[model samples]
Target: MSSVLLFNKPFNVLCQFTDDLGRETLADFIKNPGFYAAGRLDRDSEGLLVLTNDGQLQHQISDPKHKLPKTYWVQVEGQIDSTAIDKLCKGVVLKDGLTKPAQAQATSEPDWLWPRNPPIRERQSIPTSWLKLTITEGRNRQVRRMTAAVGFPTLRLIRTQVGPFKLDGLALGQSQLIKQTNLLK
Candidate 1:
């Protein structure tokens, strides 16, 4: 059986097990050896990060070709409108080329959300809104870049789900071992 760990990564934590720069890493939260992160979340983003001992399962989860959609809850600096949502859903043109159409919707900030350390900057003059976005491709800073392309800069980003696994019930820096059967789902 493969050892699958579902971790709720906190903001500023590096996705790797170790960092030569002495930053907080998976090692700080997970003591279990031989497990590796299936995908990466940027240091500024927070939430569900999958770690697995099975290399095949890791590839299936991380590879974009598999099209395992990852969902994120994002807080943007502006009051996002339907047009922006439409653009995101219709595929926005980015410097790296046009992104594939994604599931994007304006949402209210989740009441159950944990407070981020070094909280996102707030401006007195501008309003902020939340969005729930799901994308199959995991490009570097894709969510942030996508929102920016539509004129709403992301203030906070949290990945709520990846494939069948979710960050629900996991606290910051907390982790739980998932059954292989659940992972297969």
Candidate 2:
């Protein structure tokens, strides 16, 4: 049997279990030796990261062909409205060509959220808004680009969910392992 771990990675941490630059690594939190990250979370982005001790299972979870929906809780520079939501759900055109259709809905901040270190610049005049977006594909900086294309630059990005897994109860830099079959539910 394989082990699947769900971790809520914090901002500014490398996704790898080891860091050659002497920075924080998964070893700082997760002690499981054989487990490896199934996919990547850019150092700039924080949230749910799935890990597994089985190589084949790692491939299945990280591969885009699996079409696992990756959900994000993004805070943008300006207010978000129906028009922006529509464009995001409809797909935004990026230099990589048009993105795949995704689900987007206005949402509120999670309860007991902590402020980011060296927090995002606040434009005293403009307010930020939260939006829930689920995309099956992961492109480099895709979420940031999509929101920017709609006139709202992304300020803070957090991956709140992945497939059947949620970030709930997993604090920053903490992880919990679940049975592989749970992914199907």
Candidate 3:
């Protein structure tokens, strides 16, 4: 049977198991062998990172062709307005090309959220707001670029869900083994 691992990767941790620079990595938390990350999160971003022992399952989860929706809770530099939300939903033009339409809405910060180790820098005059954005394509730094293109730069980003899996019940730096049966359904 194949095995899956759900991990709530903390901010500033590398996705890989080893790092020559001695940065914190999956090795710091996960000790199991044969499992590898299905998808990658930037070292600066945090949220649900899926790992699997089966190579076929890894490709199924990480391949963009699957069109699995990834949701993020974004803290932006300004009070994001409807216009920006609409732009995000309508597909913002990026250097790479126009992004696929995304689901976006202004939202309040989650109450269950944990504090970051090194807090995000804040501007006294510029207020920040939260947004819940969902996208099917996982382009490199796509969310950050999209938000910035719409004039609201991301202050902090935390992914909350990916496909059927979620960050629910996992604490920062925590990892849990999930039965394959639970994931396939």
Candidate 4:
């Protein structure tokens, strides 16, 4: 039998269960004895993270070959226009290569968005809007970098879903044991 854990990772919390630098980590939230993260979420980002005790299950969930789409609700520092959406959907060119075509659309801010403790930096002359994007690949800082590449730097990032699982009822720093029976193709 395999076990899956769903965590609503809070902003600035290291994704790792352990941290050598004495920084806050998943340990502060998750006390499961044998579980491990499937993929890492950056310290600045928040929302759904998956963990599993089995190596093969973890690999299956995180490997890009599975084509599991991760959805992110992004607040960026500018009015996002259709041009940006078109570029993102067409696959923006990055230093590495052209990113796989992704779904990018502007959306209203989510209902339960909480204020970050210290909050994101704001410029007197700049404005920002929320956008939702879904992508199949998980690259280091990919969402932030992709948005920045199109002249809109991400101010806050919240991953809302990974495949069929989501941060549905979870709040900041909350977690629950998710039964494998609920997993979807």
Candidate 5:
């Protein structure tokens, strides 16, 4: 049987086990050996990271061809309107090309959210808003770029779900090992 590790990666922590620059990494949080990350969560982003001991499972989870939907709760620099939400849902033209249509909507800040360390910078004159965005493709800084393309820069991003796994009930910088059979539930 394969093993899966669900990690709630904290901000500024590298997704890999080691970093040449002496930055915080998965090694600092996950002590389990023989497990490798299935996908990457950017260092600046906080959220669920899936790791697996089986190579085939890793490929299935990370491969864009699988089209596993990943969801994020984003805090943008300005109040987002329906127009921006519509654009995000329809597909935003990116430098790489047009992004796949995503599920996006303006949302209220989640009450269960934890405060980010070294809080995001605030501009008193410009109000911020929240968005729930789900995308099936993983591109470098894609979420940030998508929001920027819609005229709202992301100030903070927290991934809440990846496929059937979620960050729910997992605390910051924590890791939980799960039996492969339990993944679908």
Candidate 6:
């Protein structure tokens, strides 16, 4: 039987199970052997990270061809307006290329959120706002770049959901085992 583990990765933790640099990794939090992360969450970002023992399941989650929608709760450095939101929805051109159209909207900070260990820098002259964006493709720092391209640099990024799985009910650094069937389309 295949086993899936939904982890609420804490900020500053590496996505990999092992690290040569002595950085905090999934191994520090998860002891389950033989499971690997489906996709990577940057050390600076935090939230739901899926791990599985099945290669097929891992591929399905990580492959861009699957077009599994990943939702991010991004806190940006400026007061995001509807125009910015629209631009993000329409897609933004980055150094790599134009990104696929994404679903984006302004939102209040999530109530269930835990404070980052070292909180984001705050500028008294500038304000910040939150946005929820769902994108089908996973590019390197794509969400951060997309927001910056629209003139709102991302201060904090959290992946709240990936396809059918979510970070709902999970606390920081917590993990729960789930059946693979729960992730089926």
The stretch of ten residues in a row with the least summed lDDT in candidate 3 is 176-185
Tens digit of per-residue lDDT, candidate 5, span 1-185? 78999999989999999999999999999999999999999999998999999888888899999989999999999999999999999999999999999999899999888889879999999999999999999999999999999999999999989998889989988889987553533
Model 3, residue pairs in steric clash: none
* Model 4 Cα RMSD, 1 decimal: 1.2
Model 6 misplaced regions, further than 4 Å: none
Model 5 shows how many backbone clashes? 0
Q: Taking the tens digit of each residue's C-alpha lDDT, what string does model 4 give over 22-106?
A: 9999999999889999888999899999998878888888998998999999999999999999999999889999999999999
Q: List, residue by residue over 54-139, the lDDT tens digit for candidate 6.
A: 89989999999999999999999999999999999888999999999999999999998899999999999999999999999999
Each model's TM-score?
0.97, 0.93, 0.97, 0.96, 0.97, 0.97
Q: Tens digits of per-residue lDDT for model 1 on 94-151?
A: 8999999999999899988999999899999999999999998988899999999999
Q: Per-residue lDDT tens digits of candidate 3, residues 41-114?
A: 99999888999998888888899999899999999999999999999999999999999999999999999899
Candidate 2: Cα lDDT at 33: 77
* lDDT tens digits, residue span 57-157, model 2: 78888898998899999999878999999999899999999999889998887675767876887899999999989999988888999999988899999
User: After superposing candidate 4, which stretches have Cα over 4 Å from the reference?
Assistant: 181-185
Steric overlap count per candidate: 0, 0, 0, 0, 0, 0
> In candidate 1, which residue pairs get closer than 3 Å at backbone N, Cα or C atoms, i.e. clash?
none
Q: After superposition, how far is residue 180 of candidate 1 from its true place, in Å?
A: 2.2
- In candidate 2, position 43 carries an lDDT of 87
Least lDDT summed over 10 consecutive residues: which range in candidate 1? 176-185
**Residue 139 shift from truth in candidate 2, angstroms:** 1.0
| lDDT of model 2, residue 127 | 97
Query: How many Å off is the CA of 33 in candidate 1?
Result: 1.1
